[model samples]
Target: MIRVIVCDDQTLVRTGFVTILDAQPDIEVVGEAGDGLAVVELARRVRPDVVVMDIRMPGLDGIEATRRLAGPGVAEPVRTLVVTTFNLDEYVYEALRAGASGFLLKDATPQQLIAGVRTVAAGDALLAPAVTRRLIGRYGSRVRAADPPGAAGGGGANRSGLAPRELEVLRLIAAGQSNAEIAAALVLSGETVKTYVSRILAKLGLRDRVQAVVYAYRNGLADEMGEY
Candidate 1:
């Protein structure tokens, strides 16, 4: 079974998500938390496969909770799926950076919700490519001094030792293309695209597609990657 812990500040919303998830035979709702702190503690105690997190809680907000549970250098990072009511939530990108495995809007249908849980449980990201592009383009920046370092704001791809074809694949991945889409665009087999993605992640020390997107933006590859 895919064990999950649902965390939300609103009691009704929390119960609804619990009901929807627990109803799935392949999924089990192991716990529910009304705030970020509670969810963090519950998750540590239970060690669930996935945590359905809400953004605005009374204390410790979901972003921080996600970081604590899944951020870089974590001993054992549990997958987190962040669910929010807003479609253009500002916190979504930060949540991804904090190591959320997937994202879904609260307005999503029950089927989509179930699918998202399964996808995250299976260790696949759940963000739409278009949505990923839009979010990263809007909030992702290489010139921001307060964030981190290593982005000279315009170049860095040549140093990764990626070949021309691999660089093309990296650009597509940063632009939010799936393996199938990348294959279709590059006229390669889907399996080949998967191999390229794996290589990119291994080379760059990235965790998943989400991190690749962030890396592209941070390293100024976003400027060269054309639309979709």
Candidate 2:
């Protein structure tokens, strides 16, 4: 079973999500939290496979909660999905940067919500095309953004460390292609695409596909390589 924790400030929202997820035989709502503090406590105690978080919670907020659970310094990071009523560009960008594996609208369909959990659990990202484009355009244009081509710095080492094929996969991922879609597009098996994606994430030191897509757009890989 895929154990999950639902975190939101609103009681109705939390209850609704729990009801929807508990209906799935393979998924269980092991715990629920009404705010960020409760979420941290429940997460440490439960160690759920996935956390459906709300970005606008009182206290710590989803971004910091995600960082604590899944950011670079965590000893054992848990995968988190930010499910919020607002799709603000800044919220999405910050959440992804803080190590969230996926983002979804609170009004997302039952199927979409379930798929978001499963996708992140399977080490995949869930960046809808509109969200991807919005975040890329918003954060990419910010001042002091790192230079994509020379992002690795003085060593000329191409610090991204991705090979040509892996680069292709990253571009496709940023363009919002799933493993199956990428496989069909590149004329490879889904397994092969998965392998390439894994390598790309490892090479880039990215936590998941969301970060890879962020990197791709930030560094101009998406623009040069074009869309999915």
Candidate 3:
């Protein structure tokens, strides 16, 4: 079973998410929290496979919670899926940069919510939708906002580390191509594409697809508009 914890400041919204997820045979709502502090503590105790987080919580924000759970240098990173009220909310991008595996608008359908949890639990990112790519673009500049002066563009050593085919896969990933679509585009099997993606991410030291997209944009491997 995919154990999950639901974290939100709103009682009604939290309960609704718990209800929908618990109804799935393969998913269980192991814990629920009304704020970021409570969620972070609960997650430490539960070690859930996925944490469904809310952005606007009191006492602490979801972005920081995600950073604590999954950010770089974490001893044991928990997979986080952030749910927010607005697709264009800048905080959502911050949460992603903080190491969230994915984000969904709170109004997302129950099926989408369930899928988001499963996607994260299964170790696949939930940011493949083209619309999500646009959200990334809106803040793509922030990824490189602090770059050193004269930093060369276009992935430099990052591109050099990848084999030609792996480099192609990385570009496609930044372009928002799902594994299945990439497989078709390259006339390869889905498993093969998945393998290539894994290799590319490992080579680039990206935590997930969201970071991969950000890294691509930061290094000019992909354009801000998600075009390769």
Candidate 4:
């Protein structure tokens, strides 16, 4: 089973998420928290496979909680998917930089919510390509000058480690292409594309495609690739 911890400031929000998650036989809601501090305690206790986090909690907040649970400093961080009611571009960027595995609107349909959990639980990312492009372009442009020489504002390390084909895969990832789509675009098999994607993640030390998308945009790689 894919164990999950749902954290939100509102009791109803937590209960609602638990309800949706519990219906999935593959997913189990091991715990719930009404605030960020409680989230940490519950997560440590449950050791869930994924965390559905809310950003505007009363204390600590989702971003910091995400960092503590999944950021670069953690030795064995858990995956966190940000599920928030707000659509602030800045919050989205911060959550990703703090090591959130994905983002989703709180009002997302039950299917979307379930998909987000499974995606993160499987160690993939949940942010769609268009949303990634929009969020990164919106937030990244404002801080381009302040960003590292080639670093994305999302705090992804330099991506020089990526191989040429891996870079191609990364570009397509930012364009919102699935493994099959990328395979078709590059004339490679879907399985091959999947392998390249795995290599891309390992070499970049990234958690999932969301960060890869963020990396591509922050470094201008996505723009050069054009749309697929």
Preferred candidate (TM-score higher): 2 or 3 = 3
Clashing pairs for model 3 are none
Count clashing residue pairs per candidate.
0, 1, 0, 0
Q: Model 2: per-residue lDDT, tens digit, 1-228?
A: 899999998899889899999999989999999887888889999999999999988889988999888876688889999986554778777788788988998779999999989988877778876567766656754523353321344212443477777878888888777788899888899899979987776666666788777777766667677544
Model 3 ranges off by over 4 Å: 145-155, 224-228
How much lDDT does each candidate structure score? Answer: 0.81, 0.79, 0.81, 0.80
Q: Please give each candidate's TM-score.
A: 0.89, 0.88, 0.89, 0.88
Error of 4 at 125 (Å): 1.3
Tens-place lDDT per residue, model 1, 1-228, is: 999999999999999999999999999999999888898899999999999999888879999999999988789998999997556556888888788887888888999999999999988787767577777767777335234221223335333567778878888887777788899999999999889888877776667777777777766676677654
Q: lDDT per residue, candidate 3, 1-228, as tens digits?
A: 999999998899999999999999999999999988898999999899999999987889899999998887789999999998654558877887888998888779999999999999999898847566577667766665344112234456666787878867777877778888888878899999988888877777777787877676666666623333
* Poorest lDDT segment (10 consecutive residues) of candidate 4: 148-157
Residue pairs whose backbone atoms clash in candidate 4: none
Q: CA lDDT of 54 in candidate 1?
A: 92
- On the 0 to 100 scale, the lDDT of residue 219 in model 2 is 69
Per-residue lDDT over 101-217 for candidate 4, one digit per residue giving the tens place of the 0 to 100 score:
989987789999999899989888887655667776677555553353213343334566677778889888887678988899889997899899988777666667877777677
Candidate 4 similarity to native, TM-score: 0.88
**lDDT minimum window of 10 residues, candidate 3:** 145-154
